[model samples]
Target: MSSDVAGIYARESPYLDRYVQVGIAQGRVISLSFPETPDEGAESEHDMLDRIESYLDGVEESFDDVQVALTVPTDQRQVLEAVREIPYGQDSSVAQIARVTPGLDDENDDDLRAIREALTENPAPILIPDHRIRDGPGSTPPAVVDKLRSIEGL
Candidate 1:
């Protein structure tokens, strides 16, 4: 896909690798190569960027308008508080929920309540890959199905 805007999301973990996607206001959409597992020794930002660049080597998408975004998987969200690079945000989108309520399923009701309260900050530019939005709401909003099954859940 050829578009002025491209976005990426990368993570380093056995459970979470990386994801890339490109989008335009109203044009072609591109989902760049997503490595199931990041290359060995890819423990730095530069290394991850190189890995991402290499992944996009053959893609025809426009990097000129590329807007890179990052997603710290639900498993890694809470730990991000110790890291200064990560930003926080609020909205009802799947990504936001995942970040704030990371592993919500495993979290106790009190933990979820705390997260709900912390979201008052409402961070902006909720960085997320374009493909995530395109991947549709199922995987992104995994709870939607269950929520829909019961109106009270919503």
Candidate 2:
């Protein structure tokens, strides 16, 4: 976590039917959450928020340009980076992700497990778009995944 930060922000999301919260540091997204209640006095205006709103509205927005600060281990980070490459409104299987992930033996079951674990531990859901994964939603709520996929018309 950088010392310089814009602080956490929150906004009610009609698509998810929850309050979306984000923690930002040095202009990079560090955390994301869907809370039942909004944080008091939390800032509600951010470029990311607008992007998410637009995406939920079926704009086919791409989050590839968004800067995200990840603190996972090297292997998981590599897997996550590959997951991020899954284009908007599209999906990839865990095997496919493992194949594209750097330093991984796609034929190995352990590598496939690693990909699943990385996605399950994803720090930012929509920013990373783990819902675009085909097999499952990792740790993201299944309903959220369904909603996201529905919005994407997938």
The numbered model that scores best in TM-score is 2
Candidate 2 ranges with C-alpha deviation above 4 Å: 1-5
lDDT of 1: 0.30
* Candidate 2: tens digits of C-alpha lDDT, residues 41-135: 77888777777788878888878878889999989889889888888878888888878887787689888888889999999888788898988
Per-residue lDDT of 73-153 in model 1, one digit per residue for the tens?
443334222121222211143344435444554236554444433332212111222122211232222332232223212
| Model 1: how far residue 113 lies from native, Å | 0.7
Cα misplacement distance, residue 106 of candidate 2 (Å): 2.7
Per-model CA lDDT versus the true structure: 0.30, 0.82
